[model samples]
Each structure stands twice: as C-alpha cells, then as structure tokens.
Target: MFNEEFHLEQPIRWGMVGGGRGSQIGYIHRCSAQRDHLFQFVAGAFDVDAARGKEFGQNIGIAADRCYPDYKTMFAEEAKREDGIQAVSIATPNFTHYEILKAALEAGLHAVCEKPLCFTAEQAEELLALAKKNNRIVGVTYGYTGAQMIHQARRMIEEGMLGEIRIINMQFAHGYHSAAVEANDQGTKWRVNPKTAGPSYVLGDVGTHALFLAETMVPNLHIEKLLCSRQSFVKSRAPLEDNAIVLIQYDNGAIGNLWASCVNAGSTHQQKIRVVGEKASIEWWDEHPNQIVFAEQGKPVQILDRGQGYLYQDDEAITCDRMGGGHAEGLFEAWANLYRRFATAMDRVNHGEQASDVMNEMWFPNITDGAQGVRFIENCVRSADEGSVWVEYK
Candidate 1:
C-alpha cells in the first residue's frame, strides 16, 4: 500500500516550461507531482503568450514574479534566487523538448519531460551525454509503466511464470482523430505538423508507451531488427503518420508487433499488451488496468487482480498498490507513482548520491529509456520511409 505520509525532508522546488492553461497534460503533471507532497510548484513559463502564462500561473497560486516570459528567462532569473527551482517539467510540444530540456540540464535542474524526447536519435544521444556530464536526472514520463500491475507482470516474468517468452503483441490504437480533427483543434494541429510533432505521429505519440510496457515486463529482450509500415489515414497529416505497424525481431528469438493508430474508429483508448511464452501467457489492457489476464496452457484462465496475496510480493510492486484490491486506481495514481520515484531520484542526487546508484535502489523511466524511445522512433521511420523493408536495428 502507498504511504500517504511519505515525503522528502524538503520537497523539491519544481517548475514547468509548458502545460499552461487548457492543457490537460499540464494538469496531470501538477497533480501527480504534488499528489504526495514530494514537489513544490514554485514557478513556470506556462504558455507562449507571456500575459496569459503569467495569469494562469498566478491563478494556480504561483507568484507572479516566478512565472517568467519564457523558459530561458525563467531559468536565468530563478538561478539568482535564494530558493531557486531544483527541478522542472517540460510539458511543451515535441520540437521544444530538446532545447528546453537541454537548457534545464545546463541550468543544473532535474527534468521530467514528455515523450519523443527529441527529434532525432542523435539529439537524444546528445541529451543523454549532457545529462551524464551534469549528473542530472532526466525522467521521461512513460506514465503507464508506473502502474502496479505492470510491476506484477515484471515479477511474474522474472520468476519464469511465463516460460521462455516467445511472442509479444502491443497496441495503443484509438479513434479520437479518425477524421482530421486537427483542422480545428490546436492540440491536434501541432501533433500532425512534422515541425512540431517529430518524425512519426502515432509511432512516437502512443507507440512508445506500449513499447515501454513490454520493455518493463520483459527486460531481457533486445530488438535486433524491425520492419515498419505507416500511413497517414487523414491524408493532410502527410509525412507524419496517423497510424503505423512495426514488426520486431528480438535478439532472444522473440517476435513482437506493435500497432499504433489514432484511426481505430469507434475505439476508446484500446491500449493493450499480450505476452506469450512456452508455458503460458499474460495480457493487460489499460482500460481495465487493475487486473491481468493469466492463461496457463490447458487450464482455465485466471484473472490476477491488483494488490492480491496471490500476486508477487516484491517491495516495488506491493508498495505501488495505492489501494487494496477491489478499489480503483487509474492513470493519476500511476503518474503519481512515477513522480514519487522522480522526487526520490532528484533528492538522492541532491544529497551527493549518484543517479545510477539511486536507480539501483528504485526503478523509474530515466534518460536511457527516453533515448531508447527516440531511437525506436528513428528506426521505425527509417524502415517505413524505405518501402517498409526490414532494417537492422541501430
């Protein structure tokens, strides 16, 4: 069970670079970071419009002076303060991520950044190197991996319950943008624009989330090669796909497929993953995140509910259960879990402990994972653009 009383001696002073007014992503970031009283939201460059950004920041209880006109200004000004921000969250569009994150790290601040960490794998590598040199924590919000059931799956797989994992299927297909909604929606507009959203749309947007889930569950598998085919179903979003399929060959001889689409008409966030092994298989759906379907060969299927005794008793998994079985805990809890880990990581680093050392004690999606996601996007795009031929994974 999660301990509500758990807190750092002094909450990490946190700020934001985006996720201003009317931004659902911003709200989630704030809620999750402050949920367990682990972070203190003290500043932000909330929007492109300085006036509106300041207004929004003030409305949310931030001091007007702390909400600067832009991220650079915010970082520069905050550094002179006696109580400067030690960490920041970048909630901006895809293109701004690399620059803002770079600035944050150079400013000696820990960061929690949105996915598709940068436009290219090269950029991701640079960020990784910069993070290491600065000894800063770069937490990528692969939010779903923080779910308790995910850890449960990891434990089960580690225990060889899913013997010799062979096949993995992952998808995060949804129907929200089936008909070119970006025509009027600002949020959707930036996402489809290659300048703002990066190389592939659905691939980096939702595909990485599913990929990370599989990675978390079966940590030993490594992609050796992959073939990808992508389409911009709503023609106008050209060069940036609205749907994509990736077929992967793992070094361990495991085969996997990923389907990421926003055109799965009539579907509502159909994010799911199914892992098959020689002995049995396990499946999880985000819609019903609290349960896992366990099917052993030649036996009746079983449903593994969260927080149950039958589940693994590992400290990481058990402690993630915010509420006992029979209660509901969704994405908010999941994001908060990651935030808690991020705070701990930042705190440890601040106290002269190494980031790698902290990781050895607790798991959180860090810079390395973010770099891998970016590399995955790069590989998928490369394969798709070249007539969808099988390409050796770099």
Candidate 2:
C-alpha cells in the first residue's frame, strides 16, 4: 500500500511484456513509462522467442534474474515477491492485448495496454469483463488524451465555450505500407494481418486516435449512422485496406467525416481534427501535436500549446506539463503522463485515500473509450462491407 507522498516520492514497480529489439511501439511505451519517473521496469519478457527475450531485456538494462522467459513465468514469480510490479505495460501486437492483460490482471497487477484494445468487439468485451472480475485497472494508452492541448479542447467544449457542437472532421494518413521492407517485417507484418490487427487497415491503427480526440472533445456527438468505402491501392501490400473514407451522423444532428489511409505518399502521420460549434471552433494536428487552434466570432484566433500555462488554468491539464512554457512535450511524454496520472490515482486507492469525487472527471482514457473505439472500427467495416450503406452504430 502506498500513499500519495510515498507514491511520488518512490517509483512505482513496473514490468514490460514484449517490445523486443526493433519492435516499434514497444520502444515508445518503454520510453513513455520511464519519462515521468513514476514507473520502474523491474521485470519483462521482451520477446516471443526465449533467447531473443533475454537479449532484449539485457539491452534495455533489465536484470537477467528478473527477465523471465515468458509472461507466465514473469507473472508467477513476480506475484511471489514482496516488492513486485504494481502494473504491467503490454506492448505486444494488437492481438495479444487481451491475453497479456488477462494474465497481468490475474496476477493482481494493473495494466497499461497499447490500443485497439482487442482484435474484435467480442474480445474487447471479454477483456472488459475480466478486468472487473479481477478488480484490476486496465488503461489503453490513447496517447492523444495525455496532450495538454487536448485537455484544453475538452475543457472548452465541456465548459460550454463551444455551445451546441455541430461538426467534427478528422483524418489520419501515413506513407508506411508503400515503403519497402522485409517480406515479413515483424513490425509491418502483424499490423497488416487481419487476424492480428482486426478490421479496416489504418482505421484501427491511427483512426482510433482520431475518434478518441473528436468524441472526447465534442459534446452530444454520437455515431448514429456511418457510410464507408475502403480500398487496397497497394497490390496485396497489407491484408487490410490501405485507404478508407467514412461519413458519420451524430445523434445531436451533428455530422462527421473520417479519412484514413496508409497508401498516401509523402504524408508522415498527417493526423488532423476540426470541431465546429455555435460559439467556437477548434483544430489540432498530430504532426504539430503540442498546439491547438481556436477560432470564434469577435475574437482573434488563439493557438494553445501543450505544457504552457493556459488562458484558463486546469489543474488536471497543468499537472501533465513537464517543462516550463515554450518547451515542447512529444508523443512519448504524453504517454508517460497518462501512466503517471493512473499511478497517482491507484496510489491513492492503495493507501486507503478517499477517492476524489472528480477522479472520473480527469483526462485519462478509460474502458468506455476502449469500447467506443472498437465500435467505431466495427461500424466502418460494416459500412464498407454492405456496399457502403449508412449503418447505424446502435
């Protein structure tokens, strides 16, 4: 049991599963978990292959005695230790999230799993059930939620600055599948596989991030109906569609457009979002993630940067700021902030600290976000499969 003072004063014990040498997302998670000084990687099974796992663990400075051969061994032995990981970071492929998270939860450890949550809606639901059954925390690292600017955007909308939100436009595009790589590049291979990554190519990959931001910020917006079209421009490049366009209708009579593609040339993660409302409008781009653009009648357009003091100070958003104003915080730090916030909350619970009435009001993305993300993917696929019919989400 750890108190708030004890928690921040001492690092939380943490472990990693997967993210061996050259694994793309694995490095990001590891870097993020280490950035805030809130977490310490006490153990890990960094690869599917035993030798590779040990090698990767050593490369990352994990002790050999603590780097076990498999997640099972790592979980079993760590549970016996008096000082074990308080949480585990799952950086494995999309398909492995459920199994790895289930194991961690069963071991009485909280989890920070990378996104898409599960390969299927059913699997995602089961994982949600398991988390409750084990009384463990499961947070999918939707890194954008950690951005200071995003918190500001959500605040502006929720505080009625954006009265009667009307529209959301979002796009996520990258030029990865077109680039040449190994025939079976472990990094690229699994992402393209349907069984592993689930439906709709870039939809689940970067699309989830876009959906998370728009839905989180816009008020009274729901995906009432969706019409989608998908394409695989690169000849059998990835089993999933390389490009997709989706049209959505919100329950509050608002509408949205989503465009995602992996085949787009010269676009290096050009993720952008725009929200329009009666009182104001806001826009954000992932390439310039630290800043948001705000426009409203009778006011000069404002550019809000992450980690800088906002026009309106929000403690939840402010706590995520690392350096002084003008210094930029990147994607990795955003992820770290989420973990730090989760640790702060869990530490309060561990020490018998009465939970804050507004803990749920904080910016961290929870299980509901996970469920909605999966639902969004499902809706996109259903629309595309049914000859681009406008399918209702519910």
Taking all chains together, each candidate's TM-score versus the true structure is 0.99, 0.91
lDDT of each: 0.93, 0.77
Where model 2 places Cα greater than 4 Å from the true spot, the runs are 1-10, 179-184, 237-239, 307-310, 352-361
Best by lDDT: 1
Instruction: Put down candidate 2 lDDT per residue, 150-258, tens digits, no spaces.
Output: 7678778888886888889998888866654426587877777788777756888888888888976773577778898888776564447878898988888898988
Model 1 C-alpha lDDT versus the unseen true structure: 0.93
Once fitted onto the true fold, the runs of candidate 1 whose alpha carbons sit more than 4 angstroms away are none
Q: Kindly list the per-residue Cα lDDT of model 1 for residues 1-394, writing each as its tens digit.
A: 7777878999999999999997859999999999999999999999999999999999999998998999999999999998999999999999999999999999999999999789898899899899888999989999998888888888888889989999999999999999989888998899999999988899999999999999999989999999999999899999899999999999999999999999999999999999999999999999998989989999999998988887767566545677778898899999999999999999999999887777667789999999999999999999999999999999
Clashing residue pairs in candidate 1 are none
RMSD of each: 0.9, 3.2
What lDDT does candidate 2 reach at residue 322? 65
Clashes of 1: 0
Please report, as a residue range, the 10-residue window in candidate 2 with the lowest summed lDDT.
Answer: 1-10
